[model samples]
Target: MSVFMISQLLIVIAICFDLMSFQFKQKRMIVTCLSVSVLLTSIHFALLAQWTAAALMLLAAVRYIVTIFSYSKRLMFLFLAANLVLTVVTFGGLTSLFSFAGGSLQTIASFSKSDQRLRQIMMVGISFWLVNHVLAGSPMAVMMESLFIGSNLVGYYRFYGMKLSS
Candidate 1:
């Protein structure tokens, strides 16, 4: 298969992981699946030469893995700063800005103690990512982000017995 096709396949796998993460109610299982998703996403972005997305996803993977053990404000601040630096370094005008915003939201979401809040914040991030991927012409990524929005909405419903209006 072509390299691009392979990368797209990898993105699909990552999307599956992300979808699984949303389905799990347990914190550890959710974060573990998210970490795997991030790892695969990072590899896919790198293969596509989307360095900023790759860096952010790698940072996300690290953050998920670390937080599984313990969480602290210090770690959040450190990772946020690192993510911002990477975003600036790999800036590509508006597209990079979208990634920055999405990554920032996800970073903040990582610190949330409530699963509902995390999923809510992630929905916003995925929206931004959807735009980014569309602008980059990443068809699979765009589709996945769109599905992520729907999946997150379903997650909120499952968690709270209603849509998260907030």
Candidate 2:
């Protein structure tokens, strides 16, 4: 599979792990998913030649180890901080997509209300695919789509300043 496909797969699996955790409220499964996600991240870094993968993997491993051992809030805080850094850095370039994608959020949010765990998975998975798309697609394409649709979800709307909601 392509690196993009592999990354999206990792993202789906990661969100699945998180969804499972939300359903059962178990930390271990989430950590396991985090481990797999981190491993994929390392490979992604090698593929992309970014230096953050090592640090991410280390943080993931540490979070897994501590969570497995049933750690204290301090450790959890550390994990949360690492997650914060990962969240912003990983999604930085795609923020424009999210900022624009907000309009479709009502529809998406309905799913979350239908079932809380399902909501998280959909949100994470779609965001992952979109982030991958925005980052990997041609800059020209991304910009054109974003401007055309007033959102990153270009194909979902009509042409000429029209929208699904109108």
For each candidate in the order shown, give its overall lDDT on alpha carbons. 0.83, 0.41
lDDT of the structure predicted as candidate 2: 0.41
Record all residue pairs in model 2 with backbone atoms less than 3 Å apart, i.e. clashing: none
What pairs collide in candidate 1?
A: none
- lDDT per residue (tens digit) for residues 1-166 in model 1: 9878988999899889878888878767888988998888888888888888888989999998887776688888998899899998987678788888888888888777777888878888888888888887789888778877777777778887776545
Candidate closest to the true structure, highest TM-score: 1
Clashes per model (N, Cα, C within 3 A): 0, 0
Regions of model 1 farther than 4 Å from truth: 163-166
> For candidate 1, which ten residues in a row score worst on lDDT?
157-166
User: Each candidate's TM vs. the true structure?
Assistant: 0.93, 0.38
TM-score of 1: 0.93
| True-vs-predicted CA distance for residue 68, candidate 2, Å | 1.8
Weakest lDDT window of 10 consecutive positions for candidate 2? 151-160
